[model samples]
Target: MTLEILTADTLAPVRHGFFTRAGGASSGVFSGLNCGTGSSDQTEIVEINRARVADAMGVDASHLIGVHQIHSADAVHVTGPVTTKPKADGLVTRTPGLALSVLTADCQPVLLADAQSGVIGAAHAGWKGAQAGIVEATVDAMVALGAIRSQIHAVIGPTISQRAYEVGPEFFEEFMDEGPENARFFAGGDGDRMHFDLPGYGLSRLRAAGIASAEWTRHCTYFDPHRFFSYRRSVHEKAPDYGRLIATIVL
Candidate 1:
């Protein structure tokens, strides 16, 4: 199978993609484009997967940049291929010839770019990172790299949707603790369980950060087994590990 890449028109003329688990060398649980080096998948296979993604973005394998992704609001600025991936959740680059990438299973893989300013960014935004302001931080990082927040267009790739993201009252309360208005992002689930609208929250944050435009592709990772890799879905299936989907953007 050929690689399946999802793109958004908002980030016009930028070579970017939210890669699906379609074409890759890995097999079994960590099958199909599992570019996550942090996974238990073989290092060689992961490199091959990442190299495929780098090629798709029109860059050499080493130019595809990633981070340690501590699920924080931190963003790293890059000028070239990083020898060691930094401990950050977001990456921004003003330099051309570099592709910013992030690995995700169910988290929001956000790609941001200012075509006019020649800057691009990629962020890993799980609920913790999102709530802690990863989206806003990414925009800020892009701005620091000469990208106008108003000129930056952000697109959130595949993520777990509300219907599949059941949460506990504690989780709901935590978001509510951030703000009562956050209650709007949740729907009643079974008993004290609530469904959180992660993508909606991501859009809200991106828009709130004064980006030119923001939107989610609306593809639910948990719901689509073939096209996506879902951490929650893996847990439910009692699988030992799950694959990660790679999203990348190049200047």
Candidate 2:
């Protein structure tokens, strides 16, 4: 099977992709392009999958870098090969030949670039990270690398959509407590349940951060098992674990 790499025209001319679970060496719950080293998938197989992504991005596996993803707003600046994944949710770089990557199952994998400034970024934004301002943090990191906020373009890729993201009243209240205006991002669900729009909220955050443009690919991970890996879907099915999708951007 050929690797399925989803690219956004908006990030064009720059090497980047939202890699799907199409062609990979893993099996069981970690089948197809499971690049997550944190997963229970075989370490060798995960490395192979990540190598495929690196090749697609025209870089060596060493240059395909990622963070530890603590679901915080922390973003780090990188200039070279990372010997260890830093304890952060976002990565930004102005150095050429280094690919900034993020791993996701249901959370948003956001790729950002200011081509004119030769700066790029990738972020893993789960609900907590987004609410904590991971996207803004990433933008700030990129700016530190000489990127203009007005020249940056961001694309959110393959996340769980609202129709599949049912949450309880407490979850809804969490966002509301952040700001009552956040209520607009939630739709009424069954009784006290609500459907939170993760991608919508991400877009709003990116736009509010004064980025040049931002958009979601609109591919719902939870709704598409064959092409994506969804943590929520795995939990609903009582699966022990789930594979992670990899999104990358290189300058």
Off-target runs (Cα >4 Å) in candidate 2 are none
Query: Lowest-scoring 10 consecutive residues by lDDT in candidate 2?
Result: 5-14
The CA-based lDDT of model 1 is what? 0.93
Error of 2 at 81 (Å): 0.9
TM-scores vs. true structure, each candidate: 0.99, 0.99
Off by over 4 Å in 1: none
Q: Pick the candidate with the highest lDDT.
A: 2
For candidate 2, lDDT tens digit of each residue in 1-251?
A: 99999999888788999999999989999989999999999999999999998998899999999999899999999989978789999999988899999999999999999998889999999999999999999999999989999999999999999999999989988898999999899998888889999999999999999999999999999989999999999999999999999999998
What's model 1's TM-score? 0.99
Worst lDDT 10-window in candidate 1: 76-85
